[model samples]
Target: MARSFTPKVVTANRLIQGDTVWLTANGYWSSDICEAEFITDAGTAELRMIDTETQAHLVAGAYLADAVMGEKGPKPIHFREDFRTRGPSNYAHGKQAEKVEKNV
Candidate 1:
């Protein structure tokens, strides 16, 4: 039997800055995972993948990531995707840096 489709979110790295980004409902790429568009339909997910292809100038390695709807928005289903949302792990920069600054 075929596996049932799980909800997904479109993710990629910004081509120039290498920031992790997700496709939003408005068609813009957002660095925040919570702003990602959560797609539950297999067809819609495939269609979104196609849309990502057209945005090659802005992003790279575009693919669907399993996700679930959360109070804030889409939440990643795997450790890898969760790690991506935190930005670079190299000594606190990017999203990690901003978090540190905010807590100061």
Candidate 2:
């Protein structure tokens, strides 16, 4: 017996900067995980992974990541994916910095 396929999203790290990114439906990368395109079809997920890998200039280590439907959109099911969305942990920089500034 085999496990059923779960929902998935395309994810990768930016080549130059190594920032976490997700693939959107319109064929582009988004920093916000909520903007990722979720696919339930296993075939489509594999095909999408191939396409995502072609953009060597954009990303590296491209692969399909498990996701779940959230109120906003797709959300990371794994702790690793959730942590990537936080930008950085060392200090308030990148997305983290932007968030802090907006809150002030």
Candidate 3:
């Protein structure tokens, strides 16, 4: 069964350099160009990357569900198949993949 999109709010420690972030629900987060924005019945709500200190808005992309927060704020989410290839993956793919993999 296809899952319904739930409105969510999440935060990140920081967005990667030269990457865009988005407003998942209320807080801020970073996502790749392929996963940033979505057109909903409400309107076009984009995943906007911003500088933590400067508050500058970055580029937008598609929405990613795996990149969500847990009970703790800004907790990492494993959203891609590659990351999950070996058991319950803890790695966040893309730029964060290497660091996460090493730690795991």
| TM-score, per-candidate, Cα-based | 0.86, 0.83, 0.27
TM-score order, best first, reads 1, 2, 3
Off by more than 4 A, model 1:
88-90, 99-104
Per-residue lDDT of model 1, residues 1-104, tens digit only: 65799999999988987778889888988888888889988989889998988899999999999999999999998998988888567677677565322110
Which of 1 and 3 is the better model by TM-score?
1
What digit string (tens of lDDT, one per residue) describes model 2 on residues 1-104? 55699999998877887777888887888877788888998888988978976788788999888899999899989987877778667887766555321100
Q: After superposition, how far is residue 32 of candidate 1 from its true place, in Å?
A: 0.5
Best by lDDT: 1
Error of 3 at 16 (Å): 10
- Tell me how candidate 1 scores on lDDT: 0.84
Expressed as tens digits, the lDDT of each residue in 1-104 for candidate 3 is 54455433222323334332344333334342123233232222233322233443332332333334334333234444223222233555445443222110
The per-residue C-alpha lDDT of model 1 at residue 2 equals 52
Please list the C-alpha lDDT of all candidates, in the order they appear: 0.84, 0.80, 0.33
Of candidates 2 and 1, the better by lDDT: 1
